[model samples]
Target chain A: MTSPAPLVVGFVAATVLALTAACLLGSTPMGVERVLAALIGSGDAGDRLVVWEIRFPRALAAFLAGSALGASGAALQGLLRNPLAEPGVLGVSATASLAATFFLYYGFVSVAAWGLPVAAIAGALAATALIAFAAVHTRSIITLILIGIGIASFAGAAMSLLMNLAPHPYALSDMINWMLGSVANRSLDDIALAAPFLLCGLVVLYGTRRGLAALTLGEEAAAGVGLNLPRQRLATVLGAGLSTGASVALAGAIGFVGIVAPHIVRPLVAHDPARSLVPSALLAGLLLVLADIGVRLIQSEQELRLGVVAALVGAPVFVWIAVRRQAARD
Target chain B: MTELIATGLTLRVGRATLVDGVSFCLRPGELVALLGPNGAGKSSLLRASLGLQKRSGGTATLGGRDSERLNPVTRARLVSYLPQIRSIAWPNVVRDVVALGRFSHGAAIGTLREADRAAVERALDACDLLHLANRRCDTLSGGELARLHCARAFAAEAPLLLADEPVGGLDPFHQFRVMDITRAFVGRGGGALVVLHDVALAARYAHRLLWMKDGRIVAHGTPDQTLTAERLAAIYGVRACVDGLRVALEGAA
Candidate 1:
């Protein structure tokens, strides 16, 4: 019942502002005019190199990854019918991280031109396939979620095992940095690598709107209303897997944006699962852009990770929403 | 012609027979009440009929096509279902929740054409939910939520309805109102299969009664034929006094 148009416009404006800040407030600060001029390839050579080579790619990567996570989160929450459900709930991010860590642990990063992201994406798709297979055999959505949790835990342990036996300290640090997650030094090539997966995932999630809306009435009722539960389940798993997989592949494992973004926008859409998808993506994109900016502005010897910053802000918002929902029930 | 026909329907869950070889026909302009004790497969029968639960052996046909083989949307257009559980995952508005009934018709909530809008409004008016159309489902009382689901089924305008325990939690007035709504739906040349535990109410409104026990229909006929004292004792483990359309449970059998 709530119109998402105004909220969507607001999110777009906020995102554009955040992006501008990201471009202009880096190591060597520049005016708005200088940044715009650089954007158009007419600024000073040094400024153009800084904007196009580094800041622009990183900013775009953050926004794209955030948008993917946000949309995936909304779709997963709708499909699973759980407010806490997110892209990570299905083990896509964890498995992708595990695969990337495996590659980093083995020094396979230099073996191929695009080794890490491809491995991560493959890992994500594998996890999604497993979930989809389980979805077919099981009748309960809760069972599917438990299976996802199982897969994630297994991937987490595997990553720990790999980290525990790192050949050298440098390998260990590389693995840790990936786990901590950041958009620093991301290249346009990286953006291009993850873009197709993200786009495909978002489109797949969009098609699941009707099925997810039917699920709001509960699984049995959803089936009663004529939704093909298995097909919907498969589509949701695939979509979330692709997007979440791509996010991990792009920026290492950024947490909480998926859950927090959709949670923030649910009230604005009057709790309609289908209506929350786009706004959730926009808000999440904005949040990540701002978090990346924070990462840059902080005066620390070691740059802070985007994952760490997001968890710091996101964990509390998750708790607040949970408590408020419980109170309302009471 | 029959709206629904079930033949030798059987359901098994790991060797336990839930719904045994049961068969029945629900014809248009008829209100058939499925009466049984708990765990007698009342809910399972309804679910199995709609292909929500897989049947071990049997067939359920809706509008002359196998229910299981029919596309979900096509099956839904033929039959609408009101499930027993009423909890909504989200606090969606009343109007939007009801509009979900139009899903099979290729209509989504928050976007409806004039004809779909008319059906939604009529359903809301019928269930006395028009006043609460703007209210959130999570804020509604148990009775109001029951009416909301009923309105959703009505809005579908499906020729056959499978309703499970539709009046379980309502007060007397709302209870009768629900029965009246079902009766009105039947009056409009639609068929309905309702699950009800209130024997008196079932007897009062249902033209036919299905007596199920241990996953089988033991007796089925007009209200007068199925509501006998002996049948009540056998089916419900109760000694009942039956007078015309009234059935009083005196004590344990």
Candidate 2:
């Protein structure tokens, strides 16, 4: 039995290393000396502007978004008692993206800086409520996943409709770029806007960890051990909704970091769902920072969307996991 | 003194009465077996008594307090429950599963207190599961999983245990082992209400027998008084012979 403490420490260290790389390795690359000098307020104006203004906020946003998704995914998986469960699969991210896109397409985002996240959170909560209602009627994991897919498809279609109805080509292209999902070009203001909702969601999810752990024995047994099922359910749904919504609001619809990070961390934590949250969040932050760095490294006419890279990397892994699970069952 | 008392307990689901005004008392140092045919409301009675199900009428008290009104922690400390449908959603190890019994005992959020560890150890030993403590629960056989759940309930150390067929899928050796564990729990001044389909095993191990048909208790007394051939025929629709503490089903009446 390996202790989770070292694994968590290792993940945090890896995230720090990735964050440093994300900050230094962008289009105008900075040496380690200049990066360190910029942090200490002694570098040239260009270096400081490039490091602090351009890269620092984007790196932080990517890290925060990834942490939110990872923690939310781990919590959702525990609540649903299904390893395949994730914010993206559950339609939370897609619905959130739809709401944010709606705001952006309608030019409402220009009215209030917080409008996008607020709308996204509302959409996320609505989708989560729908899923929670469906969950009560079905005990089959596959059925729940199918319901999630249906919801995701509906939201995706609505987003496309909004894209088609955009009044101008600029707005249409803006919506398209935002829907593609990226941490690039995000400002500190974006991070500030989404941080509160993400923090609140994380707190709620953390509070439900004990209940989620108890649920591994099934609902009746969990309640028998004094867990308040209704309260736990509410907390889990609300938490996952808020965090996932805020992540999408900050970085569009980055998918699979939530699902992938937890899978990577679960074994390190001895498969204890409750113990998996913090490590998952750290690993998720690392994954997103690395992916964002990958976006900058690949030289193309236009940089690849962070979401596109994540899916390309994550979809194959997801298939491999599903196949492996099927083989194990056989 | 009574560890559990239920009077006129009733459960209804959409106009269907599953348990109708069932009442019983479980005293310390007593092993009571609830016996009945399929759909006789034995499971519902246990669930309702533990406040796991809504009772349309009547009330249940644990240690002289209304069970329904008690806080979850206090209720869990007073009465432990073992449901018939056994499931493990995650691949948790056996010791971790057993330690969940201490959820209300200050084992919060994956960290177990000293007392929690001690209780889990005692329970694992009692159920003869110490050697398999580190094994993943999903890998265990049905019988071993059943014992693991039994061990979990035992770990709670609640005064009253409400078990719905705790020995349902075990082999003969394990069946007797589970009965002995229940007997030992009662021997230590704990009370138990067990639902069983095995009349002979119930007759041998239980201090008292409660026979039900439909949704009510039809007979309640010593095994000798409750396991009569006429009662068996009436309740189970079968003819059975009761010799000493053993019961054998002859045929359907």
Candidate 3:
């Protein structure tokens, strides 16, 4: 197998290219020279304003959200000892979506500017805690996944019910748009609001990486090797929850980047969960940024939703992974 | 040298008593084989001794410290355990997997110090897995994985080893090799308490045999005293002829 240095460098290169593309290709297309000049602070005021204020923050939001999802997914998969375990598929993101939507629809955001994001983060934490609690009681991976699916379905239904009773058509559209997910109209303030939580989550995960590595030996053996199992589980849950919550707040519950990016990078790190964390975060961030670029390039009457495009690309990959996992088991 | 002492250890699951009052001492430089039929609580006893299970009664001590009160890392440094189920969650390389034994010593993945690296290498060499050091654990056969976990325990350099069904999936050669590894460990003044169903192998390698029935110790002594014809019939319900440490089964009792 190849060393991690080249792989990390490759991911960085791809990300730079994608970020450049994200800047250059948009509703108002800018030339390479103009984008370059704008980037270096020598272009027209209008170009500079668009580049620095609008496009950059949106792109950054996409990347940060993707990084959060990717890292959270890797930590979760390591904790559960299942590659298929991810924030979106495990119902955490959906529940966060529901909480954010509830706050928005009920005018909770009017009372406090931080209410929606906090509610989303709390929702994610609650859902993750529920899943972790269930995980302890059951030994079968399939059962745990089914419980996640159940939570997702329930959250989806509740969100639909909220939409059904929405007081106005504009409110309905807003809810629908949020549910589909997009980084459009996102500003630096949104990134600023979510970044601290994301950083905290990543720090926690990084500190607990060794415990995740030990968990590969199975829970009991991990405990036997002197790992405090409860502490490990709590750290993983807190880390994954904070990151997932922040991502949902920033980007509205995009799915599958977590699963796909980690799955792709696992072999590069010799399948060690600890080593896979950073690379997975980088790759997933790149993938989401590229997907956002795709969303911009394809001209639709209304701009395409980033999450819809992501699901279109990622759901099939999810199926492929599940099938391969089953085949491996058989 | 450290010793493990258990007194009146009892484990009950709700209405059912899984492990009745059982007591024994595993001293350094001794290889003790715990023998029992199916569902006789051999696994439970091993877990209880390590404080991995919640015992309903009595106490277990390691080096004069209460087993339940010992810090996890301190307990791990005193004793290493190889469980019955050997499942590796990821496809980590054999060397990386074995190095996990140094977890109590603060060795992180991909960051092994000199002593940790030496211990891992020595364990691999001891288990004859040095040649397969880079292979992914998931690709290993059952016996190989079993031996790999044993090597992990050996890498810990703990004073006492508690292994459940360590030799079960192994072929004759590997089985004897595992027994020899335990014997060598004991010879080095370490202690071992192994759970096994192979009476003959236990009689051959162990300094003492603990015969348990229905979660209680029926007898514990040298092989010569424990492997009698009448005891064999009573414990295993098998009619057999006993000559010294050898038992030749004739039919079912």
> Taking the tens digit of each residue's C-alpha lDDT, what string does model 2 give over B5-65?
9999988989889898888999888999999999999988887887877789999988898
Return whichever of 2 and 3 wins on DockQ.
3
- The TM-scores of all predictions, comma-separated, are 0.95, 0.97, 0.96
Off by over 4 Å in 1: A89-91, A109-115, A125-153
lDDT value, candidate 2, whole model? 0.86
Report every candidate's CA lDDT.
0.86, 0.86, 0.89
Model 3 DockQ reads 0.69
Best-fitting candidate, scored by TM-score? 2
Per residue, candidate 2 scores C-alpha lDDT tens digits across A76-108 of 899888877888888888999998888887779
Error in Å for residue A22 of model 2: 0.6
**CAPRI tier of model 1:** medium
Taking the tens digit of each residue's C-alpha lDDT, what string does model 3 give over A235-324? 999999888898898999898999999999999898888889988998999988988988888878988899999899999999999999
Off by over 4 Å in 3: A1-3, A40-42
lDDT winner: 3
lDDT tens string, model 1, B1-253?
5479999999999989999999998988999999999999999998888878889999998888888888888888888888888668898999989988888887777678888999999999988898999998988887888889999888988888889999997898889989998999999888999999999999999999999999999999999887899998999999999999988899999
Report the TM-score of chain B alone for all candidates: 0.97, 0.96, 0.97
**CA displacement after TM-score superposition, residue B78 of candidate 1 (Å):** 0.4
Q: Summing lDDT over every window of 10 consecutive residues in candidate 3 chain A, give the lowest-scoring window.
A: A1-10
